[model samples]
Target: MPSNRKYPSLELDVSADHRPRIRLLLREGIIAVQLLVIASWLAVHLVLDERIATLGAWGPLLMMVALFTIQTRTNSDNVWRYSGLLFMLTVVLGFKLIFLEYPLLHRQFSLAMTVLAVVGASLLIRGPMDYLLVAVLSWVLVMPHIGHDDVSDYRWYLAIFFAFSISLGWINSRTYLRALSITLQIEQHYRTLSETDYLTSLYNRRALMDRFERFIESHGGGFFMMIDIDDFKRINDQLGHAAGDQVLRVLAARLRNMAGSHCAGRLGGEEFGVIIDTLSPAIALAIAERLLEAVRNSREAPARFTFSAGLVPFSHDQALADILIHADRCLYKAKRAGKDRVHFGVGEHLS
Candidate 1:
């Protein structure tokens, strides 16, 4: 006796960013095929045959219309479920072709089968279970006359069509998956290049600003700081630019460790920027002093390098240019008074 245990259906895992795009393409393609079938059937029956729509054809057309409508909905979790049901219904309608008196009507159902198979194969990213579903759907397209001795020709034609369709569907699914994978890799590569600094592997100035805008929008208020390495040019002059770069990298790593959930970026030329979560000058100063201590203690930097920072709190209504200007003034003050210290300017002073 055969075992009763059933294996679970396989699901294709896609990146969150790509899933919606693939689903949209699949929806559009499937809808276009459905509309094409409906239009072609109308032309054939109305123009050539001079007959009205039959109940047999109407059932599947209505089903396809309903499925298309459902697929058009936003944020559907189980689009595949609805689409699979629609294809199954199409296969059932394929069986009706065999009982028709006219052999020409058989070709109509075959067109529908070919369209569905091609659409499913090209647009859907799937695994073994999805392939199994397509295979079953293809088999059903040829299932109508398995026992019919009279219509051997129809069975043979459909069998060949089924074989061709299944093969094409498999090829199409593989091609789609490969293309999607390549596209995602290219996107990721470009995204990383755009957002990351070349030397320190931290976020670049532009990326940080973009993130700052979003952070300000969401959190309403935060603290921004500008960090400048003291005597940075001397390091380049004494030890060379390579050692300077190494210093920047080490400083970046230390800043990242201390930044916590806050954003940090290389703001060009031995200067970095950080956005701290708190708006309080006292708390923010404490955090900055701790960072200063960490960098002072770390042996990764050559010749006991130190940095000066200027911090200012920013509210939602404050313009970014004004905030940076105030922060820059405070930074200049710190550098002028003495290097290697944290300075704070009141946020309301500039605004």
Candidate 2:
């Protein structure tokens, strides 16, 4: 049985389309860090200081409530991310304000330093530049408490702590960059697999339909052409499937070259299609004739093979399915009028 368990790396996947997941991870880490900081402070306070008169003892709990409220109430990822960053700053500034009134809490600057480092690492997504900004904030958080009597020992501890924090922040940022690269590569690979025909390297049928829908919504008129190889079954039956595949590939290349910036795709099997925008009926017919000629002249095939094409000039209001059906009918007429010809509509044929 295949394992249903997705690895932890799956959580780190960050692409342009997956930014919400990245924001969610950061928000969750923020919540966890806030809760842990609050709980630890309360536990230590209960054990050491029975007096409730300490500098803003109730402040962290209030912030916790606020963070929880923000998390629950807001659906915007940008709000969550920036609010979490602001919360960290508010928490640090709150401690700063309290320590001014109560010098006894000056020692807690070490704790504030740790908090800034942790939150910065957990929430910053912009890599080392972000880490540099957080390092500056770390200095600002710890500077006011530096001249206290016990700060000599605290200074030594802080020096080591700052180094650790910078290293950890760097690692976290690097991890984000690596994860982003991997996500983009994965996204590109999947997009290619979904949109491209495997054998012919042309846009697949599904991608073609999607582009056609976009064209319809744009309200711009264009020419739509349907192409079918003249005798693909005979080629496969007599020569081989390989020879048939070569013919398809060569034909697809010719169509791609002819279509230029326009749309071209494999509809399925030996049938292909193209849409040319902002072109007149005569130019569209000329392109159709050129495509037919390219297939006929292809030297990569085991034998010369020709294609029948149906061309239909459509207006913005024309239904896509109806236009396609009409073009297909024209293609059918070209095949019946004799193979290797282009048909604009009924009674309009060119060899």
> Residues 10-61, candidate 2, lDDT per residue (tens digit)?
4444455566555554566656766665665567457546434554666665
Candidate 2 segments whose C-alpha is farther than 4 A from its true place: 1-106, 110-114, 140-148, 151-156, 180-184, 346-351
| lDDT by residue (tens digit), candidate 1, 206-236 | 9888888888888879899999999999999
The Cα local distance difference test for each model comes to 0.70, 0.69
Pairing residues by index, what is the TM-score of model 2? 0.66
- TM per model? 0.75, 0.66
Q: Looking at model 1, report the run of 10 residues with the lowest lDDT sum.
A: 1-10
Backbone clashes in model 1, listed as residue pairs: none
Best by TM-score: 1
